[model samples]
Structures are given as C-alpha cells and as structure tokens.
Target: MSASPWLVGPFVDMLVGSGLAYLMTLPLLLIISVRTGFVGWPVLLVTLISILVSVPHYGATLLRVYEERSQRQRYALFAYYLTGILALVFLAGIYSIPIGSALLTLYVSWSPWHIGGQNYGVALTILRRRGVEVTPLVKRLLYVSFVLSFLLALLSIHVENSNHVPASGLQAARIYRVIPVGIPSALVSVVFPVVLMIYVGSVVGAFVGLVRRGVRGWPLVSVVSLVAAQALWFVVPALLFFWSGTDAEGLLPFAAIWISAAHSAQYLWITTHYARRIDPGIRTGTYLGKALLAGAFVTIFPGLLFLPDWLGAPSWAAGLGTLLFAVVNIHHFALDGAIWKLRDGHVARALLRDDPGLAAGKAEASVGLGRWGWRVVWIGGSIALAVTVHEQFERTVTLSGITLRSLDRARDAIARLEWTGRDSDSDHLVLANSYLQAGNPDAAEKEYRESLARRPSAEAVSGLAAVRIQRRDWSGALENYDRAQRLDPDNVDLMIRRSDLLNQLESETPPVDRAAIRDLQRRSIRLLERALDLDRRRVPTIVRLARVYTRSGRRRDAAALIQAALEGLEGLASTERAMLEREKRALSDPRSGSAAGTRAGPVRPGASGARP
Candidate 1:
C-alpha cells in the first residue's frame, strides 16, 4: 500500500492533471490575437486537436470495452445493444430537425456532468493510490465541489439571454440547434456567486482535511492540481460573467472545445496506463493504433451514411453529421460509465495496483474478428480519416477566410464544399454573415434564405431580418425579428433590436397618425421593459426604455431611468457613455419635443446594439 506507483509517471500525471489551464487559455489567447488583427486560425487548431486528440479519446473507450472478451461479455448490453439503439436514433435525427436538435441537446447537456465525473474519479483514484484515506465524509466534500462546479458551468452555458449560435467550426459540426434549458439571467446573477463561493470552500475544506490525515507529496500536488484545473475550467469563467458582465455566450464555445480536448487527453492518459498494466506486454504504439482506427471509424464512417445522396435524402439534409456526432459521444459516455467503475473489482485492481499478476487475465486475441476483418476495419477507417481530414481542412480555410474578411477565399471554399454536396446550414449562415459584412445585402439575403430552407435557425432568421433592415423594409424587418424572437424567446438582444425597430417606426410615423404612433410607442415600451426585466443592469435597455417613456409622455419615469443609467455610465464603453450623455442632455432641454425623443435610424443590420 505504499504510494510509490504513479499512473503514468509523476511528470505526466501532474501535467495532465493541470492541463486544463493550458487547454482553455489557449483559445482565449487566440481570440485576443484575432481581435488585435492577428490571424489566430482557430479553425485549424480545433481541426488538428480533433484528429489527434478528441476523436481518438472516444476510440479509447471502445477499445477498452471490446478489446478483450471478458469486458465485452461483462458490458454486452452497452457494447452491443445500446449502440445499435443509438445508431437508429442517429438515423432518425438525420431526417428530423427536432429529433436531431433534442439529441444534440442531450449530448451537450450531459457533457459537463460527464467531465465532472471524470475529474472526481481521477481525484479519488489519485488519493487512494497514494494511500490517503478517502472516508465517506471526504468523498462527500469532493463530490459536492465537483457537482457545484458542473452546475455553475452548465448554468452559464444555457442562460436564457445568452447567444445560442454555434461560435466555432468545431462546434458547428455538433450544435445544429441548441435546445436551451435556460436558467434566467436574473437567477444566474443571484445564484452563480453564491454557488462559486461554496464550491471554493468545499475544495479548501477537502484539502485541509486531507492534509490533516497526512496526505502529502505527489498525491497532494496531483489532487490540488485537479481541483485548480476544474476552477480554471468552470469557476473563473462564471466569475467573469457574474462580476464583470462579460457575455458567457462569447466564451462558452471555446471553453467547450478546450475542456473537451483536455478531458479527452486525461481519459487517454489513464486508459493507456490501465491498458499497459492489464496486458503488461502490449506496446503503447500498438494499442493507440487500434484505438485511433476504431476512433476514426466511429467518428467519421457514420457521416458517410448521412451524405445527401446516401439515403436519397435531399441536399439540405446536411446536419446528419451533427446527429451522428452526438450519438457517438452519447455512446462513448455510456461505455465509459459502465466500464470504468472504481467499485468494480477488476477496475480497482488494474488502476490502483502494480502487482505482477495484474496481467494474469490478459486476453489480447481479436474477439470474433479474424485478421482480414480487422484489415478491412483498418482500411475503411484510414480512408474515412483521409476524407474527414480533407473536409476539415477546407472548413478551416473557409472559417479562416471569413475571420480575416477574405470573402473571395471563403466563397471559393464554400463553393467547393457545396460542389462536393457537403453544404450545411451553418455554413450557409456563415457565408451569409460574410456577405453582409461585404455589404452585399442581396447576396446576404439569398444566403440567409438558403440557410432557412436548409434548417430554420434563430441566427438565420435574424440574418434575414438584418437584410430587411438594410432594405428599409421596416415592416418586413420587424416581422422577421418577431419570428426570430419566437424561435429564441428569451434573447435580450433580440428584444432590444425589436424595441429599437419599433421606436424607429414610431418616429417616422406622421404626427397626425396618433393611434399608429401610440401603438408603436406602447410595443417598444413593452419590449424594452421585458429586456430590462431579463437583465436589470443592462444600461442600454434602461436608456432605450427611458426614451420610449419620454416620447410616450412619461417624463418623470424617463428622467428617473436616465438618471439611473447615468449613475452606472462609468463602467460603460466610452462611446456608449457619450451617447447616453447626449440622450440625457436632449431629454433635459425644455425646447426639445418629439424631435429630441430617441430616433434610432436603421443600424447596420445584424450588429448587436449593446452587450447583453
């Protein structure tokens, strides 16, 4: 029971344990570089990681389950039956958006909890391997910390007012349409900090308890590193949202990519250790080769089934890849749960001990498959890998072109993809955004319609509304915005945009059309008020609501709101602060009448009016 054995080695263990910091921070740094006019090429970074790390990690679980006869028999229900069931579900999703979106939602919603479980299991394994007494009470503290951290991360992701669009090419493959399980922003504002504090307290309390029990050395360092990694993965981001009002939507996509990558690497690290110990003779290279082949097949081969012509589905039936991706991940989560139980005798012996007899039950022979069968698998998987790499490279080029505002490069890559019949709703939406950026409203409108025809999304609908705004089709723009709001009911930005549009219509109405003006003013007031209710501290909403109040002859309410906004102007951007000042001055002038009321012109369509 000496604490002498390390899972891999002390260095590797510690590095993987603390790797989340590097994984998550790298995306943020890349984003900063992009913002500062440097080419970060994040799409390329994500593609490489998926091929090298993420996909293979899923393969590691399959290898663990089916590599040996005993494991296959022990987990037959999961390995054989459940996988078949999920495959059918995947196919169903290919033809039905609601079904596909729900499946995608389940995968995303489960991801944080799955990651938390891994971190919790790893921490306990580290402690037990080092001979630290993991009493029931100690386990409870660690469990609570991890659970709260997961909750914090989950809440930040699905908040009602947050943007739900896929923000990166990595996410674009899986997130067809997020079925948000929204926590209200008001509730998040109140709950996030309280839970974060308790989470921190639990971590500190667990560490102090472990130390009092004489847990020291690499075990202590490793466990502490895992805790710190979780904080970096979850807590710090929540803090940024709750404290500084940074939008979680802007950060969650990158967070999801990095956290998944880091988690996968950790999974591989432990599984490789277990595999080596269990076989005692299998080279790491051989095992990884089999794992990568299995991973590539699982991740990519199914996508071929979803090809536009494969099942005679229409070309717009493009998100079957997303469904397949979700199903694969769900399958991976299931197998991992069943096979990696520490309470199971075989699992414990393999992971916690270095006894020579650990390999006594080694069964490396191919199960039910002959040499040629494996060769077929290897050949098919390699082909799929090549195809996926090429596809992903093109995607990288398209996204990078869009990011850098090289519209021709993006258009060329997109056309090539479409020619290959690889068109997707997200790709169309992205191209539409690029078209809008290039000021080709006609092309933007066409792309947006194409996207909607493929799969109706709030983003696509919003893009169409932006095109309408650019055309000065105020009624049409309002209609599309209303439609977008229906799709994304709790979107604060959409609410503000609708209110702004209403105010614009009101100002342009003939003064003699008092009824029409009144109607517009009332609707604008309601939308702005709703936005304020969703996020009371949103200064722009307050300012807009105040202007509506003034126009509608609620001078006292308008003055009160302007004063409140002015009090908080110090934290706003300089341009925003100056705009608010001007509004306040106009509202205060005695000679100012309807002319001084907020008369927002058609803003650049698709541009957000304020931070949510």
Candidate 2:
C-alpha cells in the first residue's frame, strides 16, 4: 500500500495562509497541547499570529474606503450607524443593564451568523476559482452546514460548567439570563441531525460528481480537501464542543483561540487582496508601504480605544470603549455579510475578474447520485450516523443540564437574599455581582447599599462605587471611592480604580475647566503615588502610576516609575520581561503619546493590564 501523496502547491498558495485554511490546521496543532496537558509554544505562536494578522485586514478595508469614493459612501453610512448604536448602548448602560444586555445578546447571536457566513463565502470563493458550478441545492446545503456548525457551538457554551467545572472560575458571572429565541433546544436537537445528514449527503454527492466529471488535478483535490477540512476542522469542533461531555475543559481554549486566529487571517487575506486589487496605487511603491498601511489600520481602533483603560479610566469610560469596540465588530460583520456576493454580477466581475469562467454568467449545474449509490449511502451511513448523533445528543443534554442548574442556583441565591435581608455582607456581595451580571443594576445597588449599611466594608463600598461609575454618576462614585479608601487606606486595587476614574474625568472634561482638570489629574497621580508608596515593588501599580504621570505631562516621572517597575523583574517569563521593556521604551520615547502610540503598544482588551 502506498501512503497518500502530500500535496504542497494548493496548501501554500490557496489554503494555509488564508482564513479557513489556517483554521483547518488547528485540530492537528492542538493535539500536542491536548496530549501534553499544557499549551506550549505552538498555541502562543498561533495566538500572536492571529492578533497581528487580524488588524492589517481592517486596515486594508479602510485603505479601500480612503481611495474609492463609492466605497466611502457605502461604508460611511454603516460607520455612522455603528457610532449611534454605540452611543445609545453607552447611555443606556448608565441607566440600566437590561437594555445593554439585550443588545449584547443580539450581537452574540449575530456573531455566529457572521462567522459562519464568512466560512460559506470562502467555500464559494474556492469553488468559483475552480470553476465548479454550484446549483441552488448545493448552495443551500453549504449554507445549512455552516449554520448548523455555529448552532452547535452556541449549544456548547458552558460545557465545562455542565460537568461541574467552571473553566474561567466565574460561574456566577456566566449565569446571566439570555432571552431564548423561543426555539426549544430539543427541537433544534431533532432538526440538527436531519439537516446535518442532508448536508453530508449533498457534499458527498458533489465530490463524486467532481471526480466523475473528470475534474482531476489540483482543483479537484482542493475542493475535496476543503470539504474534508470543514468536516474534520469545523464540524467536529462544533459537535464536540457543543455536544461532547468528556474532557471539554481541555478542548475549549484551543478551539476558541484557533477559531479567532483563523477568522482574523481570513479577513486580512480577502480585504487586503480586495483593497490592493481595487486601488492599484494604494501601495504602489513597495511591499513595505503596504505593510505600514495595514499596520496603520490595525492601530487606529486598538491604539486609541484602550487609552482610557490604560490611564486607569473609570468604569464608564472603559464600558464606553468596550461598547465602541463591539459596535465596530458588529459593523464589520454587517458590511462583510452584505458586500461580498459572488452571485451578483458586479461583485463577481470585480473580484473574479482574473478568472473568466468564474466571472462568466452561466447557469449552475445540478449533480445527483445513481440509485445504487443513494441506497449505499442511506443504508451504510444510517446506522453509523444514528449512533454518532444519538451519543452527541445525550452528551449535549447532560452538559446543558449543568448550565441550567447553575442558572437555577443563581436565581435561588437572589431569592434567598431577598428573603433573608442583607445579614451576610459576603453573600450580599456575591448576590450583588450576580444581579449585575443578570442585568439588574438597581437590585445590585440595593444589595450593595444593604451590605455597606451592615458593615463599612471596602468591598461593598467599591462595588457600590462601580455601580455608580457605570451609571455615570462620577461624583457619587468618587465619593464612594474616597469612603472606601478611608475604610481601607492600604488597598492598592481601590486606589488604582479611583485613579483610573479620575484620569478619565480629567481627559474627558472640557478645556474650559483647565484648573479643575489639572486638580483632578493631580489627585489621580497622588492616588497612584500613595498606592506605590505603600508597596513600591508592585509592578502593576508602578506601571499604572507611570501611565498617570505620563498623562499629566510628567515624562521624567513616568520614565523613572517604569524603570522602578522593571527592577527585580528579570526572573519573570520572557513575555512579561519583554512587556516591561516595552513600557520603559513607550514612556521614554519622545514620540509616544499618552493615549496614542506608546512604548507599551496597543492596549488590546483582555490582554494583561501591563499595557494599560
């Protein structure tokens, strides 16, 4: 027997460097981490690659907008809508959590559609390049397959919690009330298998036709490989993550990171290609210029948006920044979803101009199987498919039950708090956090107040302060922070939070209040300084204070503070040590601004606070 030939041309030119292709490679790479019980270098490398690739793609899109008047007009409307929505969400969040939570749920639901749609688009693009005509039936099947995969992934949320294991350790925080779309999980379960079976049958039929129609060579191989990759890479993860019960804890992170990276890579490939192709002069000089242009695009949002947080901006500013990010993401999804349509004559002509067959207007051909082939597929595939589907269903239900129970427990905790009165500050604090997650800031405030009344606890005071910050009651929040500081003067975290809010207030306030703004900034600096004085070796606090000093135009103080933070940090991991150096450079560099380009680099949310 001969080993299957490993083809390299398609892997290099079409698949590996692009979105879906990179995504398909995830399962193979993750095997090392899964077996070894730790994520090694490969995971870290891919994550970095994903972040780097993701931004350039956005830049590519923006470059097109800058060059093309039509593109600008098309995108400007979406940009305005996104801006308006973001402002609404920010203002709404100040009043109540429910409205913001509802919008968040809507965005979350739309995300899978956006992601899956992109995958489907990639598949179509691949087929078009191969000149493989897809009938409406085949198109429907492809769409269904991608949609089903997303649905399964959605059902798989909190799979670890289903087994009584909280992966990220915020079980309460995760138990928010998401308004169900009224479709029963059981109904989705029943329909999913049928749709999946049909999708598989259609894919198999298509592959058989490709072979029978003498579609051999790289084109044939590419299409087959893509289908196989989608099945193994996409479908399997969705089913396992959503439907599997065992060892899901080990699998979740790998899937999340890989998917994210793949998505970013894909965006970069398509958008960059589109931009360069559309506007030949966009980067006519050299590859370096193109790279720089893409970098600028990547930097625009990430660079400025995270400034408030980096300077220790209050909860409202951070929340507003978060809302803006979400809005941009949602806009990206919408624009991408609408703009790329291969079936449209204009789009097909524009994107597929190089491929005459793909650009040509021709009727799609339907491919079907012979009776014997259908009989074989139905009989042989039935028993095997049934067993697999049944097992998945059982696992899904068992896992889903765990999440349901967690939600029930959360509700019970809230009810108990209501009945018992705020006797236990700890329990009230827990319930308060839960209420906030559940989108009930009013209840959270009541509980926090009760807790504070029972005891002048720093935690309760801070919690209340946070609620006020979210409500945009800056004075109230600062007053609470002051009280909390009095209660526990040595609390570094509280001081940092206070400083952050103060910095945000100073930056956001009008130029008319120069004296007031200066006073606020000075107060922020003092807060951070006091915290640092209490614990000089605290790297996080030191870095934070450095940020405040830089913001206050005290570059020398900022550089000195960053230098102090970097001391005795040689024992830290390579990444951590490298980050400290970046901070030092950012502070010392004359060109680096407080909120723009900094030595610490772009403040990507969810990254360690070292950047902030």
Candidate 3:
C-alpha cells in the first residue's frame, strides 16, 4: 500500500462504515468554545448538528422505501407505515408514564445489541472485502467477541446499579441456582478487562489463521482495523464513562449521539451505493443531490410523523410526542432490518460485487450449524442462558422481601472476591441511602463520609447532613449543609433541607438567649429566600419559607409568598393545591400566625408538610 493510502485508509473506512463526523465536529466546537469562552451555545450547536445528521438518515431511508416501489412491494411498504401509526396510537392513547418508562427501558437495553450487530456486520464486510476466508470457528470467535463484550458491558452496568454481585462458590450457586457453575459479580466488575481480552483473543485468533494459511498485507490490516474500530467505538466509550465514577445514566445521551452518527453514516453509505448501482443517472453521490434529498426528506416527512412533539402543549394535552418519537425509532429498526438484506441478488451485487471468495465465505458462515447435534447443543445452551438471566432478574425484583436459601451462598462468594478501587461517589451515596433505609445509621454515615472524602459531591454532603440530623448532631448537620450549599448553591432541595434543619434545631433548643435564637431564625429565612429565588413556583418551598418568615416576624413577606404560590398553582393536583391553600389560610388568618411559628418542624425537601 502507498504511504498516503496507509495513512488515510483507516479514516476513509470510518467515513463509510461509521462516520467520525460528530467526533470531528465536537472537538472543533469545543476548541471554539475555549477560545470564545462560551460553552452553552456549543452544546446547542452539537445537538442541532446531531439531529441534522441523524434525523435525515431516518427520513432518507423511509423516503427511499416510499419512492422506490420497484425495490420493495406495495403491501410491505404500506404495512410499515401502518405499524408506525399503530405504535404511535398505542403509545399516545393508552401509554401511561410507567408504560412509557418501561418502553424506554426496553429500548435502552436493546440498543447495545443493535449497535453490536452493526459493528459485527461491518467487521464481516471488511473481512470479505480483504479476501479473508471466514471459517465456522472464526465466525464463532467473531460473534463471541461482540456478544460477550455487549453482555459484559450490560452486566457491569447492572452490577454498578445494584452493587450486589455473587462470587464463584456459594454466591454464584445462589445466583445461578446451579451446582458446579458460577460467574462472580467481582468477575462482572472486571468486565472491562474481560471484554478487552475477548477482542484481543479474536484478533490474535484471526491473525494466527491468516499466518498459517499465508494471507497477509491488506487482509491482516483489514481485520485489525475492524477490531480497533469496534474497540474505539463501543469498548472505549463505555469504559471511559464507567471509570469516571459519575452517574453512568448521563452517558446515554453521549453514546446516542456518536452511535447514531455512525449508524446514519454507514446506512447512508450503503443505501446510496445501492441507489447508484440501481440507477446511475439518479446520482445520489453528488453533494447537491444528497443535500437536496436529505434536506427535503427531513423537512417534509418526519415533521408530519412527529407533529405531536412539536405542538409543545401541556403534559395533559392530546399529545403522543414521546410515543411518536419512540414509535418512529422502533419502526425504523424493523424497516431497516427487513430492507437491507445482503442475501438478495441486487444487494449482493452491490455489496459483494459478485466476489466468489466473499460469496464462499458467506456460505461457510451460514452452514456452521448444519449438523443436528451442534444445532441441538447451540439451541439448548441459548435457552439455558436466557432462563438464567430471567431468573436472576426476577430475584432482584423480589430481593427486598424474599430470602432465598441460596442467597447466603451468593453473598459468601461475593464477600470473598477482592475489590480493586474504592466505590464510586454515586455508589457510596446509593449505599448510604440503602443503609439508612435498613436502619443502619452507622453504616450510612460511614458511606456518606467515604463518598465526601473522595469528592465534595452535593448529594453525598446532603446525605451526610441527613445522617447527622438523625443522630441529633445539629451543629455537624449544619456544617455539612453549608459545605453542600457551597458545592451546589442553586440546588433548591439542599437549600430547603438546610433551612428545615435550622428550624428543627431552633425548635429543639431551649431559649438560653432569645436574641441568639432570633439570629438563627433569620439565617433560616435567608436560606429559604434564596431557594425561592431559584425556583419561584415551588409551592412547598414557598409554604415552608413563608412559615419561617411568619416565625421571624415577616408576616407581610409570608403573605406575599403565599399569594405568588397560589397564582402559579393552576396545574397542581387537588391535594397539592389544598396543601397550599392551608398555608394560605394560616398566613392570612391573624389568630393562626403565632401558632404557625411555634408548630415548626423539618420540611421533607421534595414532599409537602402534613397538615402543619
């Protein structure tokens, strides 16, 4: 290969297989932001760019499917649209928030598999293009790399979320409900390393086959590039986010942006190639043609499909915005799967260019399970794996109530496994809360302290403060809250909690010096005022803050706060409105003002006061 091709080949492959367009755009955008000293606009810019690149691909595919009736049957195309409409209707009319949440969960869970499938397909395509003969064992190794990596990544996330993993002996026994077989949660925690090993093993295995059989040059490079790209795209991103110790939930949007960009680019590359092959005169490869087509499809089509989201009405309005968006995605997945059949003659002609070596490789891959014994074993193993996963999930759901006999076994196994680093701050916060719920204040306090030592996280500080409050360490609680407020001063909940904590301290303390007590009460009023400034329409905050104001001889401010809350209470539930009304009544009534001040208690941050 020429030096230019050697240098540029990997990048060219990326453009066709998984566009690094967003990757390129993002870094450049960040550089500009650094220079200009404005970060928010870049975020919006990147979002718009992602939508422009991704939405068009979906639109273009649907438009092609609709316009090119010769490539696809009429009924099939009609049914595709019908399915989307039905999905939207179901999502819009019958879908509760819980149902929508469930669907979103399912979508997120399935996404890794879908993305992995694409990566595997691209790898296979590269292997074929480079004239590498893919054997049955080679195919299995490749598939295992993708499957194991995806599963390990998924399981790592699960373990992080639940923090309870069984090791090899008893814990594994309890977890799997099996003897002599076990996979430890600690092993799951090392999923990143395991995934790397699998990918490396597959690459080594492929290279060894090539060396023994005397295939070198571009073929070896092709295999390596495929493996490297998969690692860069999937493995590295997951591990980077995982090891960062921040909430992995936040990484979803980042993953979606780059993954969608890759998927769109790959789909467009192949589809445009097919289009060019079918009709040379149509010229989808040209800049203007692509722009006009992609632009038109984006403008005219998806808007009509996703009009509900665009309406921007209230939550109670006749809108299925989320449903429509999700329906389009699911429908797109199904439609793309059905349409892009490489086995078809036209597709094979376009993709394979009638290469006999590639064709033979494809045949060998399909014939892997021709033997009945092998098929039986494969089927049995798959069914067993599925059952094990299902049972584990069921156990997790009922873990709080049910005590499985084997759980002790699993716990013992988990306890024996050696951990490497300290738990993430988020994990510590979660464990602290869980310990608190289980009536273990000591453990909860320790976890909170450990979390704070690692990072001055607002959540951890707030949790630590709450623990101090439970232990009646009033000064300690106030100090923690002050530390937390410095970290996240705008967090209304933290402010309200601190304000309430001050009130509780005041109520519990006997008045040694009335002036000192009044100073403390004034501090509470200021904290609540800051919270109100941050979130003007929070009725509960208004109520609690108003109560504080009334106690500290600011009844006029309390009355004004109640009036402002009432003005913004249109969409609140009846109970919520009623709660606010009670606050309104207390503040308005001259007789109850003194009573409201003396009857102070801790406000539960996110919840309303109980008839006080």
Candidate 4:
C-alpha cells in the first residue's frame, strides 16, 4: 500500500531539520553575538529566506518522481534544469577563493530579492496550476508579503553587509552583481554548473540502469524541452540561489540537497499538471502536508544561524561547511519520503485523477503540445513583434552605445555656453569639467566662481574644490571642504582630504606649528575610525587607519592590522584581490603615508555616521 501524499510534507521536513540544527548551533552563535543593542535581525531575516527556499525543495523532487513514472517529460525537463543550475553555482565558489573571504561573502549571502522575484512567484504559480485556487484576499496577502519580505531582505543585506555596496557611485562589479556576470550569490550563479557535473557523474550516471534503452522519447523530448524553458530560466535557478556558499568544499552536500528539494517542485507540479487525468484531489493536502513538513523541519531552524556565520566567517569553511552538511542530510530524508509516498499510492495518484488533462486526454502529447501548438506559435510571434519594436526604439536613441540623449546634449550645450560667454561662479562650477576637458581653463575658472555663488551643491562645491587642489589653492580647497561638510556630514573623503590640505599648508608656512600638525592628525584619525565602525570593510578607512598608525610610530601595529583586514578578503576572486592589494600597497608605502602628508593648517570637519 502506497503512502498518501501530504501537502504539508515539506513544511514538516523544514521544521524538523531546522529544529535539530537550531538546538545544535543556536547556543554557540547566539552567545558569541549576544549583547543589549544587538537586534536578531539576521535570525528573522534568515528564517524568512529559508522558508522561501524550503517550499520549493520538496516541490522540485516530487515533480521529478511523478514525471519519471508517469511519462511526464515536462516535469522531467524541469528537474533537469535544477541540475544545470547547481552546476553554475558551485563553479563560482571556486572563483571566490584567494581574493579574500570577506569580499566573497557577498556572493554567497542570502538576499530577499530571490525570495520575492523567484520563490513566491513559482510557489503560487504551482499551487494555482495544481487546482489550489487562492482567494482574492489570500492572493493580495501573498503579494504584499512577497514585496515586503523582499524590501526587508534588501535592507537587512545593506545593514549587515555594507562593504558590498560602493561609497556612492557606480561600480562595474556591483552593477553586474548577479551570477555568471559577477559572483555566485544568486540562483543562476556559476556554482550550480560545478554541482551538475558531480550529479551527472554520480546520481544520473548511476541511474543509467533505470533507462529503458528501447524507449523512443522523441515527442516526449520536445515536451520536456518546452516546459523546461520555464523551469530552467526561473523556477529551478531560484532554488539554486539558496545553495550558493563560500567554496566547493562547503558547497557540495548542500548543492545536492538543493537539487533534491528543487526537483520535488517538478514532481508536485507534474502531479498537478496531469491530476485531471490520473486522479482527483488525491490526498494532495495530506501528502503535501508530509513532504512539506519533512522539508521545512530539515530546512528552517539551524540553517538560519549559519547565514550570519557564513556572512561573517573568518574562513569559508566556518561559514559554509556546516550548512552544506546539514542540507545533505535533509536531502536524503526527502528522497526517502518521496519514494515511500510514491510506492504507497499517496499524493501522485490523487492528483493525476483530479487533473482532466492527464487521464481524460492520455492520447494527447505529454506537455499539451497537440492543443498548445497554435498557442505557442501565436505567443512566439507576439514576443517577436514586441522585441522588434523595442530594438527599433532603442536603435533610434543610440549611436555606438552613446545616446544623443538629453543628458549628453545638455552637457554639450553647457560646454558651448561657457566657451561662448563668461559665467557666474555657480554656473561655472557646474560646467567647469566640460570647460577643463575642452581646453578652456579660463572659462572653467570663471564658471567655478559663478557656480559657488549660486547656492553650492556638494557636487558643485566638490568640483571647485578639485580645481583648487589642481592649482594648489590650499585655502580655496579647505573652504570648499568645510562648506561641503556642512551640507553633508557623512562626506568621509572630504574630511580626509581637508586634513591632508591643512598638513600641506604647514610645510609652506614660515613657523609650522607642531601642535597644529598633531591636532590635524588626531582629527583625521577620529573621522576615519568613525567611518570604519559604520562600515568595517571601508577601504578608505582601512587605508587611513594604517597611515595614522604608521605616522604615530606604530609600524608593527599597522602591519598587523593590515593583515587582519586582508584576512577578511581571502575568499574574494582575483579581481577583488587586486583591488584589495592596490589599497594595501597605497596604505603600506611610507612615501604615501609620510609626515609630509600630515603637515597642518586649519582643522578639518569630523565624520558622523548619521544618514545624509
């Protein structure tokens, strides 16, 4: 007798698994991080992320089993996609090593966006398709939760991991931050590709014994390919994102679990997709209850604790190794539950009976191809038309990737206006860069003053300040930094730069005051330290602290601190390592951090961590 399917199976699994890990690591991580001011934001944040991930784990595996037994290639295709995804994610784990561990943590950290953008969408889509119609009110609730969870996730990521975001401008690595394009933090990350190789080499490779050689699956293959398009592009990869970790040694077992759970979605979906044919509402909620509970217990509790540890691990092993091991154990449990349920006539048969398309239309192709052929042609054509229109519109606005757009035209016009006539200080400051680049320093000078006259913006003020720095107008640069600081207290760079200028003027002065030099250095160090506390991974702060230490005759201390900071960077990729190396060199060089770099004049503005 086959065990009946339980809709709550996954949830049960997650609760159980998480409960176990929770009992194990909670006392350790919590005790280490416990303090009055500490918000357990990471815990709530991670739990939220894990639930989104757990739901799909069993969903994917269930889908695979149903597809294989029922000749449902669509579900099989979806399951295969889970394979491709894990392959890519594990590959990235390889790449993050050597650069530094802290730098690479961003690639493996959990994000709320994946839950909203991928998990929620897939889960509801599966449920609705499986005949579990959501009420309008329920739908609204899910939508709101989805958005809120995502926003909160993003905030938590920012609050907890500030180093990944740049100071205030566009950075290529940050801009191209997804997997394959950047690191392996998301579902489509390169890590999955590595895991895929292992699976094929082992699981599917061994499952070759299960293949029926004489079977011809030509139509079935096409069906698989079609449904697979959705699973590959969005559904499975969403699950894959959760599997991304710091490195391969820690990623292997978790990748296995991720693949197993993600495949269950396909199993469940296949049962739903054909429930109209094979069975009707067949113990779906019950079997779902078991699979879901099984998955949830395995996924939820202890895993959340590891998220922070991984995000803050000294080594990749500390962060990801334990998490991966836990994931594998859950995967084994899920695989067993699914097989047992299937053999015992649980949820799968009930679902097949309920879905009209599966039993009533058995002669029809597995993926609804016969009826869906025309629909495909129409949808394909519509997509082509829309794409063509978009291309044409974009082409009209661009020439060699540079748009003859409003911003560019405005810049060009500003240049000609400055060149053709004299401008006020405020206006000149706004257009000084254009004039400078155009070989019109006189015009730039005139505009710089005019721009300053017209209620100086930080951008405009910084512009004039740079011009002063260029021309050795120390007084003017100090004046600009003071004004900018007034406008934006968080201008960390401006504070440091101002300190530098005060030092420069002292050397040119007749009786340079030693007292003033000490004062400026003290002020600069204070500002730098504040900024570092707000964001520990701040490169400028790191460099500035080293310089201050070197100047104060703490040479060995400076070196040790540098090593500690670099330790945070071990798992980073080569590009990231290079960036850190550059910063390290700039800090360590005596010439750059020389006493001359610390001569004093007027004091600079201090640093504050308050939001601008």
Candidate 2 at residue 194, lDDT? 70
* lDDT of the candidates, in the order given: 0.74, 0.53, 0.54, 0.41
Whichever of 2 and 4 has more lDDT, that candidate is 2
RMSD of 2: 24.1
- Candidate 3, residues 114-221: lDDT per residue as tens digits? 667766666666566555567878777777777765665455435434321111011111101112123465765576576767767876786676667676665555
Give the Å error, residue 194, model 4: 23
Stretches of candidate 3 exceeding 4 Å from the true structure: 1-14, 18-44, 74-86, 93-95, 156-196, 210-219, 240-256, 285-323, 354-612
Any idea what lDDT model 2 has?
A: 0.53
lDDT of 3 at 27: 59
TM-score winner between candidates 1 and 3: 1
Predicted structure with the largest lDDT when compared to the true one: 1
The local lDDT score (0 to 100) that residue 304 gets in candidate 3 is 35
lDDT string for model 4 (1-612, tens) is 113222234443222211222223334543544443332333233333333444434433443343233433533443345434433443333234333233233333332233233334443433432344445554454444444433322332333222322110011121122222233245323544444444234323222321222212321222223223223322233333334412221212222223223434443444333333344444656444434433443232223333322443221122233223223333333343334232243344443223234454333322433445534433543443333233233323321233223334444443433331211233344356555545455655566665554334565666666666656677787787778778777876666666566555544655545676566556657766766666676554565566666665556666676677779744656655565567567556766653224433333322211110
Q: C-alpha displacement of 462 in model 2, angstroms?
A: 13
Residues 72-110 of candidate 1: C-alpha lDDT, one tens digit per residue: 888999988998898787777777778878877777667
Clashes of 2: 3
Query: What's the TM-score of each model vs. the native?
Result: 0.67, 0.48, 0.48, 0.29
Q: Write the per-residue lDDT of candidate 2 for residues 534-572, one digit (tens) a residue.
A: 876566666666776776678788777667656754566
